[model samples]
Each structure stands twice: as structure tokens, then as C-alpha cells.
Target chain A: MTSKALENGRRSKRHIFHKAKVNRSHAGNAVVFTCILILGAFMALPFVYALGSAFKPLNELFLYPPRLLPQNPTLDNFIGLWTLMKSSWVPMSRYIFNTLLITAAGSAGQIILASMCAFPLAKHPFPGNKFIFRVIFLSLMFHASATAIPTYIIMAKLHMLDTYWALILPACASSFGLYLMKQFIEQINNAVLEAAEIDGANIWQTYIRIVMPMVKPAWLTLMVFSVQSLWNIGSSTYIYSEELKTFSYAVSQVVAGGVARTGTGMAISVIMMVVPITVYLITQSSVMQTMASSGVKE
Target chain B: MNTNIKLHSLQKRRLRDGITGFLFTLPFVVGFILFIFSPVVMYLAMSFSKLSLNDAGAMVFENVKWDNYINVLFEQPDFLKRLASSLGDFALRCPAILFFSLFIAIILNQRFHGRALVRAVFFLPVLVYSGAALMFSNDALSNDYFKLLSSDSDETVNLAQYVISVLGGTEDSPILDIVSTLMDKIYDITCSSGVQILIYLAGLQSISPQLYEASSVEGCTGWESFWKITLPMISPMILVNAVYTVIDVLGNPTNTIINTLYSLAMDSGNYGLSAAMGLIYFLIIFIILGAVFFVINRFVFYEENI
Candidate 1:
């Protein structure tokens, strides 16, 4: 037993030594860093260009060799966009409010419902568990457009045609969120859950307390995806009311206003992108923290 | 008598567990039936029928049997051709996107200075490539700029061609064709991979540090640990990402099949033909997903329940 203990100590020391060597490898680190930097810049180019173009004056927008950075930056585009929005039939703030309402409700509902559904499917053995999962998986294979008309008809029948529920309800039912949450939940060790059960915590309580907190990163990632898609929802066939249109729909209108509104269009793009990017930034730190502690030990 | 009583309670507990499980999944089951399954069934029916509006403007379905399918499959000049090419593109790009995103995810998961900023930059594509920003970037002025940029790269293309010839490969060789196609599509691959990278990063982080520690204690190298431990641990995510990539690529707005279907439905007002085409597209997607899921599922290593 003393010899076994000694061997274990030596092994751990060697492990620590190896880890230090890996971390202190400067040449490999430099190569990885440089590659990431170059790729990051390449990926960020279009967004940076868009930002610059939003600030460019009219003539600068039309420059033949389009400048990556606007030579003469101005706020004219933003001001123009404001004026254009002010002249619209529906108020700009209404569009923003509509988008916020839809995105918030849709994402929250999806995360909650998907997680609630995913827990049982992931952990519990029921009569139709596998069948339900298979169905959900199959649903994710097709594009949403294939179901658009029939969904519209269903919405009409339910008398939900013009309201925000038209958008929120369908998003709440999205198969992708359930699938993602299920996968993440499956990574959790069953022992943690069994311990909870032995403590007399019921299924629902355990799910709320144990499963939900454990899979925080999954739901957060789902939020990013849900918000991104819901925020970008443009004119829908089911919603014909001008008051019910989305901010993206309004932005598309400004974009459609022809060549003269190019500056304002770019400005609107910046505005539209800011919300989702901000959402990602705020949640990213939490996502990383949760993921760090998410590992299950045998 | 005591054992019989214990068995009765055991059966009751199982019954409770089953009911509770069913109740938990109730919301999704209801939502799926109402929203997804019903619509899919309706679309299938529409695919096999002639959809026309009545005087009251309600849709009328006249049974057309196989006509719509026949028209889409054999008669439409560009439909089959576009489908074939799009499938080919999907075959090439799905694996590329998966590999590239995994590579980027591994890099991002490493501890480094300015990691958060680099991550934010990497996720920029998910923001800018969707909605209004995409439309803005595809505007005429930007298109002109891109055209000019390509023209300016003529010298670089010539140099590449000369190098290829020197390497004993013709410009139009199949290998060169694939390489050039991939080269041209690098921006697209990068743009479409943001969410994928996020998924992978999450997957990477969920892998227990204990496994790595144990492997290191066994004198395993970093490379070996990656293949043996990390790969198996992340295989489930690989399945998820693979399915997502396939669907995303096929359903992309710019895909030829999608564009053709859109035009057939909206521009030409041929709903029946469009529905038929959509069903066919969905079948292809289902087949591809099934193949991917089957192959990846076999390799996916789920930790056994304790």
C-alpha cells in the first residue's frame, strides 16, 4: 500500500510537470495565436466594412473602389434613417417594441418548454420516450418554408393570425431547442440525479433545481439562437397588420427604398445587428462560466 | 406476503415514473402535433394535389395524383439539374464547415490573452450574415465592389494556375476543380460556421477535466488524449453539428433548389409545383440526415448510467 501511494504521488507530479511543459511551449503558442488572429480578422472584415459604410457620406458610399474605412465619416445616414422612420405609417418604436416582445417571449418560452420536455426525454424512461425523440429529430430535418402555408392555415383556424402569438407559438415549439437541450442534459451524470431522488426531491423539483441549473449553458446557447432567428423575422404571410410588423421588416423597407437610401440602409443594418450581438456578448461570459463547471465526473 | 407487498409498491413507483415522464413531455408533444406534424401532413397532401383558390378565396385541393411529382421530377428543365448540383455542393461543404468550425472551436477553447475579444469577433458572422445586414451586403454597390476585387485578383489567379501546372496538374483537373471551388467558398464556409463553433466550444467545455488528468497521469500525450478522450466525448456533438450543417446548407436561401422553389411558388404562382418540389427537397434532406445520424450515432460514446 505504501508503494502504491508513492507511485500515485510520482504520477501526479509528472502530470503537473507535463501540463507546465504544454503551457510553456512558446513556439506552438505563437503559431496558434497568429493563425487565430488572421482568421478572426478575415471573419470580422465584412462587419467592420458595414460599420464604416454606415458612417460614410453619400458620395463616399458610391466610391468605385469602395473604401473599407470611410474617408469622411458622418452621422448623416443615421439622421436620414431617423427621418425616414418618422415618416412611416407605423411608428419606429412600435416596430422595436414588437420585435422585443416577440424575441423575448419566443426565446423564453422555447427555453422553458424545450428544457421541460427535454429533461424527461433525456433522463426518464417512458413508454413513448424514444418515439417522441425520433419525431422531434425528424422534424428538424425539413426547412420551415415547407410548413409555412399549413402553419398559416392552422394559425388562422386558431384565430391567432395577426397577434404576436403567430410568431411566438411556433418558435416555442421549435424542435432544434429540444434536441440541443436533450443532448446537453444527457451529458450530466445520473448519479447527481439519483442522489437528488434519494433525498426525496420529486421529479419536477429535481428538474427545476438540478437539471435546469446544470444545463444553463445549453439554454443560454439556445437563447442566442432563438433571439437571432426571432429578431430577424421579417414580413410574415400570417401577419398583415402594419402595426404588427417587425423591426427587421421596417429595415427591409428602408433597404428597398432604392439607391438613394443606401446610406440609411447601411445604418439600419448596424442598428439591426446591434441587438443580437449585444445579447451574445452579455450571455457569453455566463455561458463560459457555466460550461467550465458543467463537466460530469464518474 | 411481505415480498408481494414490496413488489406491488415497486410496480406503483414505476407507474408513477412513467406518468411523470409523459407529463413532462406533454407540452412538446402537443406543440409538435399542432404546429409541425399537422403542417407537414398538409404539405404532403398538397404535394399530391392541385391547389387552387375558390371564389371565396379558400384553397381548393383537386386530386392530381402523380402529375405534380412527375412535372417537378421530369418536366421541369432546371429543377433536377439544380437539385443534383446543390446535393454535390452540400456533400462538399457540410464536412468542410464541420471540420473548420471544430478547428476554430479548439483554438478558441484554449487559454490565451484577448480570448473573449477573439471569440466575439468570430461570432460576428452569425450577427452580420443574417437579416438586414445580409441584404445590405448583397446590395448593388457592394456587389460591384466584390466584382472589382475579384478582377483585381487576376494576377494571383495566374500565379496559382502556373504553380498548379508546374505541379503536373492541369487547370481543369478534378482535384484542382475541387480545390478552387473550396477556395472560392472559404468566405461562405466561415460565415456559416459561427453557431457551429459555439456548439463545439460548449461541447469541449463539458468534457470533464478529470479525464484529461487521468490520461496525463497515464503518460498520454496531448495529441493522443485528443483522439482517444476528446474525440469520443465530443462525438455526440459531432452528430448534432453534422445534422445542423447539412440542413443549414441545404435550406440556405441562396441554394439553387431553394431559390427555384421560391420562384415557382411566389413568382409563377404555381403552389402545387412548389409543394411537390418542397417534398422532394425534404425527402433528400431526410435521407442525408438519416445517413449522417446513422453513421455518427454508431460512433457516439454515451457515458453509461451509473
Candidate 2:
């Protein structure tokens, strides 16, 4: 028993020495980890504070050294939020439906449209193919702000202002989605296409059948990117129609005017902001994992 | 005769493929011309014309001169000051955002507990706060409202007066004063490019673990291995983030040029100056981005090189 105890003591000493050596070697990484955590908390302050304030007693909100966490919290803010700008501000349900419709439609349209655009760029060898791809690439980096005025004017001319078509038609041919799809398709093996050809499949058959299966990861990535535009405030802000308001527009409206009441305003914004993201988290949990993983190339 | 037949078949195949490609890109081409190309040309034309609300509140287009541009650029005080302030804000915010985000990306790439959850939280702000969350939170955090509570006077509650108590610290305060100066840059970084850190982290992980193993076998420590191994591997992603951040901020509607455009269309009826400002904004971004691409191409080491 005494011999065993001594042996255990020696083993533990060696383990401690090894761990200390490892920690000393990676002291820099630990420092970096701490900095990252702090910055993350700093960046997350508004959201965390919103979450905290959303649940806090209205009387406690203005307390200095603001409570990072709520004390004696309730859902009264949410109760108040649901009824905000109650008159003539479009029903909350309508706003949510509008947003959902736009997000679903826009994402579906982009995937289909971008895939069609990507097919030739990825597989077909045509003259000026490189030039066409370059044009798409250049436009992919173009910000909405740069050409928003033009887009607005065009939408007006089409009599699409304040209508569903305003959101749908202008953004259908997304250069970002096309460029991303082409990049994804290029990673698929030529062997897959060759196999499909051997099986007497046409070009479309190969693309839809063999090639697309390999690019499931790409599809999820595009879905996430499309949601950004679909839910974006910038485009909605410029599109300029009250009846055509999206989820983002609704959220902005809750805060924009006569919202001098801070906690309730924050509560409304948080719900509007979180509703879609929460839905995404639940439905696309697996896709989120794949999305992050695909961000890296092997 | 056999050579002629084969050449004819080849020509026909090329023609078929071209037609297919054109059909695929037809929507983008049509959308681009109708929405992007033609509208830009029209706006430039509109700037030279007289566009205003009539007594009946209908928009009337009358051909005017270069007066609009001259008035906004040379004569307007709010326009110039807002432009200068926005330029200052952009210059101040962009670098701090780039460094802090890339730095966090490196930290996240390390093997750690709760790494995925950490990434999700970091990315959450970017996805949500860029919209309504900011405007609402801005009201709460905007001003000093604490003073209003202590005073029992029957006046209206000055909410900003209450909140300003937290941030009313002097320029001489030790820790928080530094935070104050850096806070705007940090908030912008958090709001705009927090998701980018996740992208950069993925780029870092895609780096082969073998590189570190090989470096260590040759007696390289973590720091030296980083300089030799990490930066080169993630350079392409760095370019992606830089261009995205720059273009995103430059095109923000709250920006002076965009606000000017909105006001001109809605309030002022000075279409010509708005067009010039919009074009000038686009030109500046284009030139800066071109310069970035040139430098990045020269310095960045690609995996293909490896």
C-alpha cells in the first residue's frame, strides 16, 4: 500500500509538470482567448442589455452601472410591444407574413436563378465565358448603396413601388448568389460528370443528379446569404413603401417615431430581430453547422 | 470531305452551347440593364433637368442647368459638414474593426471548450443588431437620463439626461476613457463584421495541422509557426472581409451621399447634386478597392503557391 501511494505521488508530480510545461508554451493563446472573450462580451453588450432590459422591471431600467442581468423580471414589455403603434401601422401578423414570404421567395428564387447562371460558368465551355464570369464577379462586390437610387427609380417605373414585385424582381438576379454557386460547383469532381455522361445522362441530368448532391453544402451557404438580403434593412429602407413593409421595416417603425419609452421599444425590436433568427436556429441547426464548416476549404 | 464534315459538327455544337448559356443568363442580363445600367444613366440625365413638385403635388421634370451641383457642393453648410463627419467616422472605424475582428478570428481558431457557442454568440450581433436592434438600443444608451430621477421636480423625465450619467466620465478617466474612444469602432465591428470572424476562423482551421507538426519537428514554437504558417493561409479571406466591410459601410443609406439623395428626391428637389454625390461616392470606393486588390494580389500568398 505504501509503495503504491509513493508511485501515485510520483505519477501525479510528473503529470503536473507536463501540464505546467504545456500551459507555459501556450500562454500567448490563453491571452488571446481572454481578449476574444472580453471583446465578444463588449460586442454582445447591446443584445445582452436588450435581453436583460426586455425582461427587467420598467422602474429598474434607468439604474446606473446598468444591470447586465435583469432583477425581478417580467414579460410585460412583450405584452406592451405587441400593441405598439396599434392604429394604422399594419398588423404585426401581416408584417411577419410579408417578411416570411419575401425571405422564402427570395431564397428560392436566388438558388434556382443562380444555379442556372452557375451551370454554364461551371461546366459549359463557351466563348466569352471568362468575361461573363468576371462581370458577375465585379458586380458581386457592388453594394446596394452604390446603385440604390437607380434601383428605386427603376422600381418606380415598373410601377412596383410599395409592392411585392419591388422586393422580388430587382433582387432576383443576385450576382453574389451566382458567384458563390459557381465557386461551389467548381469544387465538384469532373469524374461525377463523366460518370453521369457514361450513364447516358444529358448535361441537365448530370447537373441536377450527380453534381448537385455533392454541393448540398453550397446550397445551405447560399440560403444563409440570401436570408441576409431578404431580411436586410438597407434595401427595405430605400424601397420606400408603407404597405410593402418587411420584418426589418416593422422593427424600425417600432423604434422610429414616438418611441421615447426605452424598455418597451427595445422589447419590440428584440422580438422582431430574434423571431427570424430563432426560427432559423431551430429549422436550420444542421445547416448552420455545415455553413460554418464549408467556410473553410480543404 | 471528312475534315469539312467534322468542322461543321464542331461549329454547330458551339452554337448550341452559346444559345443555352444565353438563355441561362437572360434574367440577369435583363435585370441588370433595366435596373442597374439604364437607371444610372437616367439619374445622370435627371440631374440636368428640372424635377420638382408642382402646386398640385405632382412631379414635373423641367430641363435645368448645373445649378443643383453648384448649390449642394459649394453653398450648403449641412451637406459639407455631414460629409466631413461621415468621412471621419469611416476612417476612424474601419481599421480598428479590421484588426479587432481578425484578431478575434485567430483566437477562435484555437482548440477550446464551447467554441461553437462562442462563435454563434459573436455572429448573433451581426445578424440581428444591424437592423432594428441598434436604433432601439441607441435610444436607451444615448444620453444621461439618471439626473432626471433624482430631481423631484414635476417636469418631464429627460431619459437621455438619466442615461448620460453612466458615460459622463471625463477625458481623464483611466480605463473607461480609452473604452469610450474605442467604443464606436468596436460597436461597428460587432454589428457589421462579427460573422466575418467565423469565416476567418474557418479559413484558419482549414490550414493543415501537419504544417504545425512539421514546424515543431524543425524546432519552431507557436509564435514563429504562426508567422510562417497561419497568415499566408488565410490571406484570401482577409481580402474578402476587407472589400465586404468597405463597400457595406460606404453604401449605408444613413451616409451623407445617400441621405442627400433621399432628401433631394423627397424634400429638396435637387436631383443633379444628388447624382454627382452618389457617383463621386461610387468612384471613391472603386478607386480604394482597386488599390486594395493591387496590393493584396502582390502580397497575399495563396494555397496554390503552397
Candidate 3:
């Protein structure tokens, strides 16, 4: 009877109301917090395992079931990676240099070319502009693989196979890039470009001196994107030449050494993967938001 | 005469600007013609002709009269089954990954320590897992991942054989069927490559924070805010991811179209047939992409509202 009376008193009080309110909110937050932690871990797992594997020795790797962390960790893997990278039959540095050049050239080339073409498509009233833009736009709908074989044959007939042009030239004028860039620059006020033109800025001068600076952030964001893409490119199983390989291709070559082979040449891969990753970390920190947004808006 | 000359010069200047604009775009025009347009036209030509790689090391071209297309589509062994399976798998996987990624992305979009790091980590799979990289590192990732489902097989593959053995030991038990079904589900989820997650994370971060603030002031719960604000805002992105995912799946290593192309070109030495198959694949993708664009176009909510 006394417990019932106390419960009745509690149920009738303001203190009870405040206490229950806090309790309900706490429960809600706790559920969200738990979900966030699990999701974060799920997102972070690949990097963890990749880092762990880079540091781990072979014995730990080939264990019946994998363990999450290395037991007897050492820097031997890094040291081995350094030397093994240099010892590769092919010139590793040339491949690295070529990849960097291609990536830079491609991204800059695409952005400039796209920006210029997009200006007219978005701002000007040129005859056949919409038709031409539509042609480029519709080509994007065509699956890349569908064109891969035909493009390969085309490159062959032009005597451009197994060359840098083969790798870089095909994607120079990207349909997706043009569409994206046109949409972006279109959002800018024509008044802005018109004002610049009124101040003795010719079309070329207006684009270079004014429009380019305004879109600087988008440029960096796209560059980072293209770098990340160029870093991971390795579709050259058909373009077979040992000398004409990129880092990703080399890494693939190592990992896919043979059916039974243990893929001992991963020292090069361990080191090479770090280069792009490091570059990405440095550049992406500032514009990660921008890169994310460009993709988002698209 | 002086006024006439000035007017003529102004007209000449306007003409010059148009010519310069065309010239500025000339490199791209040239590239488009040489790389994209010409190849497409050439492929059409090559499709109708049997471009045999001759003994003398040149394309021995002969007109095949619709035979290549007919054979690849209707009569090529494993063609229809493989194509259907690829398409079905793509359909089943796309939505599941889309939802899963959005779920994870929303969770990441919440304020937290290491927010930048978390976003970068989410983006890593997209950066690191190129088609070649995946083909190589799949062994590494899968070997580790496979253990989450079952113990070491003493053999690597042949999942059905293991199922039969488990059944044999249990003698047609209900538990065996349950285990197999659950295993199948796990495999299905794991097989979804993680690109969808990156795409969704990009979409989530694009949502303006002000919307959340406004929604909160209205006494909206997190769930309500998500449904009301976030979903509609990122619908365009979802469409882009869907389209990209569908098209990207065709080029994936396990894809049958890619494998068939590889085999026909290299093994059969019939580049003509492969070209025809490619055309068919491209045609199919074009149709599907058009439908997707039309579907998404009706629902796009532009940023002007926010």
C-alpha cells in the first residue's frame, strides 16, 4: 500500500515528468550513437585491413582464418617494398612519371576544353549548338565497354596502339565532363561574364582572367577526382606491353602473378599504392566537400 | 566611306568572334570526330563485314550479311543465359546497394569527430578498388571475407558441394536449409561492390545544413528530417548513381558480356563478332539509360528551393 502511494505520488509530480523526458531522449540518442559507431567501423574496415596487411608478414596473412591485427609487426614490409620496387624488371619511375603526366594533362585538358565548349553551349545562341551538345550528351549514354573494342581497333589502325596517345587521347574530351562543366558554369550569372566583357575583356580574356578564377575550386575538385581515377587505372590487360605499364597495372601484375604463385612481388604494390593515396590525402582535405558536392549535384 | 568602313569592321569583328569560338572548340571537335564519332561509324562498318585477322597479318574484310549479329544474339553458346543473368544480377544488386549506401551515408553525415577522415575513408574504396585492383585484391579481400560465412573448406570453392555435404551429415534437417539460405543472403550482400556507398556519401554531404537546422526548429525528429528533406534533395544523385552503377556493372570482371568479348576476340579470332556483340550491348544500355533519364527528369527538385 505504501509503494502504491509512492508510485501514485511520483506519477502525479513534475519531477517525474522531467526525469521520464530525459530518459526518453537519452534512449533515442543512444540508438543513433550505436548506429553511427557501427557504420563508421564498417566504412573504415578496408583502410584498416589494407594498412594492417601492408604491415603484416606472410605467416600472419596465410593463417587459416585472418586475424584483424598483426601480432609480430615490423617495418620489414616497407623496407622490402622500397628495394623490390627498384628491382622490378621494368623502370618503375618512368611508369610513375608517365602516369602523373597523363593524369595532369588529362584533367587540365578536359577542364579547359569542357569549360570553353560549355560556355558557348550554356551562354551563347549558336546555331546547331544544342544539337551538337545533345550528340555529346547522348554518347555518354553509350556504355564505355561497348566502345572499348571499337576504340581499340581504331587506335590500332591509326598506328597509335601501345602509345601514350592510346591511353590519354581517347578520354581527352569527356562527354560527362562537358555536361557537368556546362551545368556548373551556366549557374554563374551571365552578368558576371558580361561585366568583364564591358571592361575590355575579350571572350578569351574574360574566360581566362575572370571565369577561370571564379571556378578555381571546382577545377581543383575535378583535378583531384581525375588524379584518383588516373591512379587506379589498369584496364591494359589487352594493351599488353610490359614496358608500357602504369603503377596500377604493375600492382595488378604482381597480385595476379600466377595461379599457384604466392604473389611475392607485392613489395612494389605496397609502395606504389601509397603514392596516390598520399597525394589524395594532401589535396582532398580541403576540397573533399567540393568533390563530394560535384558528384552529389550530378 | 569612313562610316561604312567602321560598320563593316564591326560586322567583321562579330564574324571573327564566331570563328575564334569555333577554333577554340576545334581541338575537341577534332578529337570527338577522330576518337568517338569515327570509331562508332567504323564499328558499324566492321559489324557488317567479317574482319578476319588473316595469315598475312591484316584485317581480311568480307561482308557477312547479318550473320554475326544473329549468331551472337540468338545462337552463340551461353549468350542469352549469360546476358540475362548479368542483367538480373545488376537489377537485384543496384537498389540494395543504393539503399545501403544512403543508410551509411546519412549516418556519416551526422556531426562527429574525425568527420573529414571518415569521409575520406568512405571514399577510399572508390579510389583503391579499380577493376584491375579488385581483380587482384579480391583474392585478398574475399579470402578474409569468406571466413565470415564459413570455416576453411580445405578447398577454395564449389559452394554447392559443401551444402550437400552439410545436408548429408544432417540427413535433410531444417537447420541445414536455414544455414544455406542465410549463407546465400550474406554472399549476396558482400558481392555488392562498395562504389554505391561512395556515391551516396557524396550525395549526403551535398545536403545543405540549413535545412536540417530549419527542420529541427519545427520539432522534426531525425527520421522525419531525413524523409522530408534529405531524400528529395539527393534524388538526382541517386539517379546518377543508378545509371553509373548499371553501366559500370557491364565492364566488371565477372560480367559475361566482357568475358564473351574477350573470348570471341582472343580465342575465336573473330573481332567482327565481338564488335557486333558490343553494338548490341551498347544499344541495350542506350535504351535503359534513356528510360532512367526520363524517369529521373520528372522528379528532379532543383537547388533553387533551398
Tell me the tens digit of each residue's lDDT in model 1 across B192-252. 8999998888788778777888887778877788899889888878988998898888887
Question: Tens digits of per-residue lDDT for model 2 on B1-306?
Answer: 999999998788668767886677667667666755566667667667666678998667777677666666678777767767877877766666677778877776566787666766777765654545444433322221221111112333332222234557433446555554455445555656664564565456445466677787765656677788888766666765666566666666546666666666657645667666565556667776677667775766654344
lDDT of 1 by residue, A155-272 (tens): 8899999998899999999898898899988888888898888898889999998888877867888999999999999888978999999988888878877778878877877788
Model 3 reaches what TM-score against the true structure? 0.75
The weakest ten consecutive residues by lDDT in model 3 chain B span B143-152
| Greater-TM-score candidate between 1 and 3 | 1
| TM-score of every prediction relative to native | 0.89, 0.75, 0.75
TM-score of 2: 0.75
Per-residue CA lDDT of model 3 for A1-298, tens digit only, reads 9999997786567456556766886797689768656544644454454556556676665553444467887666666555666888988787777677767777777777777887767665456777877788667755455466677777888988877777677657777666655554554446667677667677788778766655554454455566666666675633567777777676555555543222233333445456656765665455344423221122
lDDT of 2 by residue, A1-298 (tens): 9999998997788678667767886786677778778767655555666677778777777665465578898888777766675654667677778788888887888787787778778777677778877766655434555455567767777878777877776666777567556655654446556666568776667668765555554555567666765776433644566566776666655555642456666676566557546634543344334323222223
**What are the per-model numbers of colliding residue pairs?**
0, 14, 0
TM-score of chain A of 1: 0.91
Candidate 2 docks at the CAPRI level of acceptable
Candidate number with greatest DockQ: 1
Off by over 4 Å in 2: A1-25, A82-91, A122-125, A130-149, A176-222, A232-244, A247-261, A279-298, B1-18, B54-96, B134-175, B201-233, B298-306
User: lDDT (CA) for every model shown?
Assistant: 0.81, 0.62, 0.62
Report lDDT (Cα) of residue A192, candidate 1.
Answer: 87
Share of native C-alpha contacts between chains A and B (below 8 angstroms) recovered by candidate 2? 0.28
